[model samples]
Target: MHLWYAYMTPRTIVPVIFGLLLTVVAVEHIFTMTILHGKSMPFSTMLLSTSGNGSDLHCPSVRLSARVLPQIALASYPGSGNTWVRHLLQQMTGIATGSVYTDEDLRLHGFPGESLSNGSVVAVKTHQLYDETFYDRTILIIRNPYETFLSLFKYIKANHTGAPIIDKYITEWGSFTANEIGHYGQFYTSWMKHLDVLPIFYDALKQNLTQELHRIKVFLGQSGIKGNVRCALANADGNHLRKHSAMPLDFFYSKEKRLAINLLINQTRKMFKDRFRNVSESMGTWML
Candidate 1:
């Protein structure tokens, strides 16, 4: 605290802090946009390459495994626990899943998914829109949208290294919330329309790991690996995730604010009502 005060006072800090913070946020935003569109570009060439015909964009060469299992796409809105799924699945199969946004934790546990040339079957996890060309099968994971946004808010806060960035985050909260809600709604509606997708509900997953694991194994044609479920659960440690979702009651701050948020969630639900009504028990955790 003393060291921080030596460099500046509160009056001199906001602009400098906002500038640096905005740059990081902006670059990360660009990265997410490109990854969502391309689903597999390496960072070095993500914004660099173009198609031969000059009308399209092509990602730089990725060294891919010649002998690989069917590629499965594990996808969800950001903060819907996509990384957790990768960790568990990798533990179970002794194979790694890749992501568009590389995580050091994933690297420590398995391998960087974008450059996946490993001979084992690999799952490519992403928050990208449903891209048919990216995988042979798809897994779409959904959490309660309200909780998803709230978790995302906390996640952005967690990623900051020095002082808290809550002020800036709150300033930008309206934009962030709008984009996330709209994008996830479209993501759910679009992906669920597909005939091949295997859906996983985040809350249900936390409630019953064994059941979800069995279902995923069957979906990925790895039913033989069912025995690895316990080890995978033990290794994945889902309880840690539960703590992340524990927001204080006053987090929303006002009854009116909560009502508005609920209204937005209701509209989103109605947008996909026909598709989700029958599957509410499994997919509509947001309704509760």
Candidate 2:
């Protein structure tokens, strides 16, 4: 009786212990290699790239595995035309508004909706700064930093929800261009440091949406994304794009201020022409 009980206990206990140990080791390895390795790009890069002129930053040519075709993230800061790009891409790629997913952390009500995973290729819009610790493939969209700040300022001033932090920027309006102004400064710094990901100017989206859309389609194609993704991205009509909703110029400023800001934005954007062309061409031409 004792020998029978001993044999049965040993047989059952050994396999259970072995299975548990193996599971723990596998989990530890996955955490160490994937999450802790610092191999993926951080969301911070997306936010920072929108702050200033980072045209000269050297970036590695983005490479993706042929099997995955890579996920494309439309990264930028607030008021930097992310939604506009989304509107254009959704129409171009046939990604329904119902299909586009908002950032999980920023979702208004903690509602879990459809993840970008349902589609073969995921294109997300991000407002986080780039940090090389998260994100797979980043496509940065930039607006003039001054205008970015001005728009934010106007939005906040209009909303005025009694938050104390609002004063930090308002009080230092004159010092906005200084390095001390972190909100927009970090964006400028990041853009200057990373050049590998493609950068699209807000001005370009406004000036010649058709050409820029074509350039974007080419970039995605080079990354091995095809079929529905490619066709959806390349299908935007500039005329239709011009009609998309935006932060109305009248939201915070008089007509004169809006015109002046527009003029300034155009003037500064002209300085970035060469950089835009270089980045776009490097991504190659799409069949569209």
Candidate 3:
């Protein structure tokens, strides 16, 4: 009798333990799916109810514009604070900004309108130079070439995260600068020639965010801004903003490299000055 009872206990206990383990795994999976994908599930509902705090399940305030909008291009060279600008625009307008390419990170972060470029979103981001037929207007954000290069370098090294680049890549800056400088110049030059383009300098935007945002708002004709401009200003530096230690130009570039960058900068500045002389005069501001 004693031996029979012992065998039965071990067998029953094993099945019970296996069942409990399976239940735990199922609950864990449901919770994970609910949090990441925002799917509603029976277990997830119960879990949230018990926890009494469901802020983690909240989605960003940004939503698709109810009315179809014109396809505006948010054009910029890589690493020119384009993401930051998109954040500000979405936060201010409560409209999701689109991108030609669907960046999963940005999609998960706050850009629910990523990869949507069918005139539904507020604006579509693009690094590539597109023609007039593709977009109604272009918002070109240009940064200092030197700083832009460094930011791009760090951004690539950090794998698109906001983390700082390791010091080891400092040695590679010269070749990187040489390789990318021409492309940067060409990108700006091409966009500058676009018939309907609003060129906004990165420095100017940073210095006067409110003014810049207001200008952008007017350009986009976005009268239904759901978010307060003051609130957007207060939270200007969203999680997407990357903070890097300031390194001198000499630290990243040799004299020759610096000369090449300066020459391009000057040429670009001249082109801008020549192209926008009338507009600058009218606006009373040469934003280079």
Worst 10 residues of 1 by lDDT: 56-65
- Compute the lDDT of residue 135 as modeled in candidate 3: 86
Give a tens-digit lDDT track for model 2, residues 168-223: 54575444434323554455445444455777877777677767877777776676
Top candidate, metric TM-score:
3
| TM-score per candidate, chains pooled | 0.62, 0.45, 0.72
Give the higher-lDDT candidate: 1 or 3.
Answer: 3
The whole-model lDDT of each prediction reads 0.60, 0.47, 0.73
Residue 28 error for model 3, in Å? 25
Predicted structure 2: clash tally: 17
Error of 2 at 269 (Å): 8.6
Clashing pairs in 3: none
lDDT of 1 by residue, 172-229 (tens): 6666766665676677766765556777878878888888988787876652323355
What's model 3's overall lDDT?
A: 0.73
| Rank list by lDDT | 3, 1, 2
In terms of lDDT, model 2 sits at: 0.47
The residue ranges of model 2 lying beyond 4 angstroms of the native Cα positions read 1-69, 96-121, 154-181, 191-195, 227-288
Q: Which of the predicted structures, 1 or 3, would earn the higher TM-score when compared with the native? A: 3
